[model samples]
Target: MRTVRYEVLPAKGTEDKVIAHVPRDVVVTVTASPVKGLEPTLDLATRLAAHGYRVVPHVPARLLRDDVHLKDVVDRLRGAGVADVFVPAGDADPPAGAYGGALPVLRRLSELGSPFDHVGITGYPESHPLIHDDLTVQAMWDKRAHATYIVSNMCFDPRLLGDWVGRIRRRDVTLPVHVGVAGPVQRAKLLSMAAKIGVGESARFLTTHTSWFLRFAAPGGYSPERLLTRSAEALTAPSSGVAGLHLFTFNQIAETERWRCALLDRMTG
Candidate 1:
């Protein structure tokens, strides 16, 4: 079985839920909220690390004020013993600082001698809502040197995910990819959040693709088994270089853990 990383929002009540339901074995990645800012994210990460869980905190570039702010954030995480961080060009309108994207922040991190052991950069399997497809691909190529691995944006189609891996490899961006998939979540909320943002571009693909509703919104809700099973072949292929799974929990910590355990039982059974 591949490693699993559970992504949680640094929202109110989330810390308690994670400490309760998410096992220490699974890596927990705390997300940076544009509305709440990075303070909550780092705070949650520090607390989670204190709880003995390996945590990866999102350090969105647009959230920082400048290089000094970036240093402070890095120092804070290092002090808290956070070894991994996921850097994305944040969606903060009127960015909080000099960084408008992740590249500048990533460069600064390297210049600071990169305190974290692992750093992840975003990958788009489908067309970005704003960035051109060619540019998105080229952006991955550009970031290959700075990031340690790639965690792809949420993608429902197995074919698209496989094709994206192929495309990136062809472009010589060979970082292992951690396939991003949504955990068990309420269909209604998932669709609504899909129109906005979460850990990935799930909103654009799920909302814009009308036909997905019937398939994803089964009587229960969106379940990741079908997608993950279908993705196994591509993921395990020698050339694919898939590192593991990154589940966008959407703060459904308990349900996500239950579903993951059940699925693993089925696979083992």
Candidate 2:
């Protein structure tokens, strides 16, 4: 079960592109942004669901207004037949309401009888620029009870990712991990799209996951195949608890899906 993430931007034909390219039943997780608000995410999820995709819209804590708003959002998603959701602490400086981070929102969701079948929380393999490693690990431990799975943020180094997964298991967090990797994309186009959507936050993410970008930008440099080959052992190991791939398509749906299919064919050929 592969998952793909997409930013909720105002680009035309984004949903159409996704429908045309993305295979049905693959979970498409729409990203929530402080700049774009949550409407687009929710709307896109609904549209995708109607098109027979298992859509998961990110419910960022900072964007939510309150418990009431959370309930309303849950109701809407339920009505749309969405069974999965991912929660992240958004980049918003001042949160929209009581929820300051994903923990509180997740706790609230639990209190609401856990509306969704699968609740996902973010994990970091490398050190976060703003947060300490210890706190990030502890946060995962604390949220383990509420979340059904973990979706790791984009990480370039396979060794670092394997070590991070081992550390999480040692800390007693057993959530299945969906390793994040960038789908096949040109570095220039990815950066261009990110800049158009939200320069500040997107740039920060690129900085964090820049290794692959730098290599990809260089002539005939590193590719997703190399990353997968390097990481395959740890990801497939039983002890590692890796569940699946979470490709950061960056809205390059057509190209990403094509790459995915080609990779699958080659692997099974």
Candidate 3:
């Protein structure tokens, strides 16, 4: 079965609204960046767990200052019965603490002997604004042993993603991948989510890459209609090594869910 994962971008009470719409069988991952402070991380994870979703909250490296902080995070997640976590370097400007990158955090997590059944890291199909392409791939390799899977950043081009996945597997990094793509979102709504979530870095990243914006604005901003066919073709190939799909819904939970259901029906029919 194809796996569908929903990203929960922390918004004020948006969690309640969003989670209400998601089916229990769908995997929900809470984004750590939006929660801002430390407390929200555990709070949101707990809330999601209470609501019956298998939550995978992000654990950003920059957010933790020391071993103590790391332990607290792990303890909290374990307490909430969370078995999966997505670790990213985060967009926090000027490191919040000693951890400069995800690799350091990955090593530390392994040292802590976390009980999580799965650990996820990020992959960029398009280049990240601050990090180099080579560095990003190396980071994946460096963290591969500790990570059970990879969740890619948003990408509009299916070709780029297919090629990127091919290249990653060729390099011998065989971690299962959750290909990330934005859900059926309106342009204005996407930007609003971007602005509200403080995704200035991502907005800048998108703007700098004119092709990305141009493609999104071309006709249908980002409908999964064609995207899924192309993505599925790529993922179904044995060499692709992709495990699932991660949708950045931009909080268009209702529409995204509708689209996913329709797609699932089509596939079943």
Candidate 4:
């Protein structure tokens, strides 16, 4: 329960916020925006690595132009002392180049001698908005060989998460799964972000997952501890292979940190 990782955005002021509010001990993962590509993510990751944090930057397959691009990225990250990476078949509509998904990119990384000691692949605990549940599971089976672990996308339903974990075990996917949860988000902040992103996206986000929406819209807003405590049995069960937490901070670094510490304090006492 003490172990956790904070996933940050590749946006302006993100670096400053992390440096200010987050400590050096926490494992930090940078997310790649489908629209913004991977440059900002890489830049922030490099800066964070230089600042003495164990940085894991997302290398979305759809963003890479080719093997040449992949090599360049590997070289850059290596130079920055990065030893971990998260590869996802990004949400980009028209992929940047030859690579369309994470498999080819993962294979290419192996061809490049696997620069990263830790390579993370995505696991959908709940059904993905676009991809079918069956395809997501199959994707994990295909990606298992290349990845060192799995980081699930945002999932609000703990019971659903538990069921997904059981299914993975039954399928013989033994990789350690890091459960994804949003950290200490405020309702007003959520609405503000929704407004900023525009109604089209907000509506899509709000409507896609009913459980997620209810939790978000519920009284007093979202609280990670609610999910964590409810999901404890699943997380610690034998053969669950639940590694730790992958918190979606959404740049709420200070609040997330405080929430984490508070949760830990409660656990201890």
Candidate 5:
């Protein structure tokens, strides 16, 4: 079975909807917000775990206060039986404390005995709006030793995504990649959610990657099938090491889940 996962933001008071709609045992990655801080993420992860889902909370390095705070977070997740975590160098405009990026937090996790079974780091197929492409690639190489896998950031062009995956493999970072795709989302809602979560770069991302936004702007909007089929050859090849699909739901859980189920039925039928 190909691994399937979902990414969700820690929107205030959305826990009930998530618990009621998301299937049991699904890997739900809770995202961190610069405005909201990490408590909501931790709280959602705990609640999701109690409801029998395998939860992976985003531990944004910039938000963490110190080593003591990191320890506390690990302990909390451990106590909740959450054994997966995704670390991202967050968008917080001046990091709160000692840790500046995901690499430092990843090292600290190792020093603290690595509580989680699967530790994921972010990948960018599309160039990050602020960070240079070379730096992003080098960052992956630097963090590979500490990470178990890579979860790519959202990208629209499958050919570009495929090329990026191949480039990573050639560079010798062989961690399995969970290719990221936006689920069935409306453009206005996506923008609203992005703004609400304080992901200002998302606006810049949309502007810089106008082609992607245009696809979504069309009638019936963007379809994951387009990306899936286009990328299949590369993703399924022996050398590609593509693990599965990671849907960026953007809080549209019901629509995302429906799309996933329909696609699964088609694949099986």
Candidate 6:
């Protein structure tokens, strides 16, 4: 069976809806902050685990004030029966305290001797607006030992992803990759999300330096079929170093789940 991982933003009143509809066995990871804070992350993970899903919550290092905060997070996750987590240097400006980046928090987690089975780190197939490509790769190298896998951020090109996989393998970064793709999202929904999530800067840097806003605003919109098919191929290939699918559901749960089921049928049929 193909695994589809869903990304959930830490929004008010969203936990119930997401947990109600999301499949039980698929991996569910919570965003550290769709807006900001640790409360939502812990809350969402607790709900997901209650619903019988293996939940992974994002721990934004910058948000943790100190070792005490880090330990509290670990303890909370452990209490929720969470065995997996995703650590990233978040978009938090002027980081909270000692932990400004993922490296520091990952080191802290290791020192705490937490028993999480899987830890994930972000990968950029598309370039980040402010960060250079070399630094991103180096971050991956720095965090590989702590992470069980790499979750590539949204990229519209599969060839780019394939090339990235090859590059990662060559670099001796053997951590499995969860190829990230936007799910069957409506055009309007994507634009709405883009607006809230700094779509302008995101598109300018990641989406070919072209006007993604203009593209989304046009009559004909976008579909991720090309990228998904290519990713499926890449994942199926031997030595590709790919693991499974990570769907950026954008909270359009039903459509994304349907898309996942249809793809599974096609692949198995």
Off by over 4 Å in 6: 197-208, 211-221
Q: What tens-digit string does per-residue lDDT give for candidate 4 at 193-269?
A: 54443221223455676766876887965668888888989989978998899987767888888888887898899
- Looking at model 2, residue 103 earns an lDDT score of 97
- lDDT, candidate 1, 1-269, per-residue tens: 34999988887898899989988889999888677889999999999999999999999998999988988999898998899999999878789989999998888888888788899999988678788888988988888788999998887778888898888899898998998988778877677765554554556567566666567776754457877778778888999989899988888889989988888898899
Question: What is the TM-score (0 to 1) of candidate 4?
Answer: 0.92
The candidate with the higher TM-score, 1 or 5, is 5
TM-score, per-candidate, Cα-based: 0.93, 0.92, 0.93, 0.92, 0.94, 0.90
Q: Which stretches of candidate 2 lie over 4 Å from their true place?
A: 1-10, 195-203, 208-216
- Candidate 3 regions off by >4 Å? 198-201
Error of 6 at 49 (Å): 0.9
Alpha carbon deviation, residue 19, candidate 4 (Å): 2.1
Highest-scoring model, TM-score: 5
lDDT of 6 by residue, 1-269 (tens): 36668876666666776766777788888876525577877988888887788998888887888998888888888888999998878766777878878898887777777468889988887777778877888889999877889888877667787777777787788898888777778877765775565321333443444654455456654567756665666667779777787887777777777777787798789
Candidate 3: tens digits of C-alpha lDDT, residues 181-205? 7788888778667656744246566
For all the candidates, what are their Cα RMSDs to the real structure?
Answer: 1.9, 2.4, 1.9, 2.6, 1.8, 2.6
Stretches of candidate 1 off by over 4 Å are: 194-200, 208-222
Better of 2 and 5 by TM-score: 5
lDDT of each structure?
0.84, 0.80, 0.79, 0.83, 0.84, 0.75
Global lDDT of model 2: 0.80
Q: Per-residue error at 155 for model 5, in Å?
A: 0.4
Q: How many residue-pair clashes does candidate 3 contain? A: 0
**What is residue 191's positional error in candidate 5, in angstroms?**
2.5
Error in Å for residue 119 of model 1: 0.5
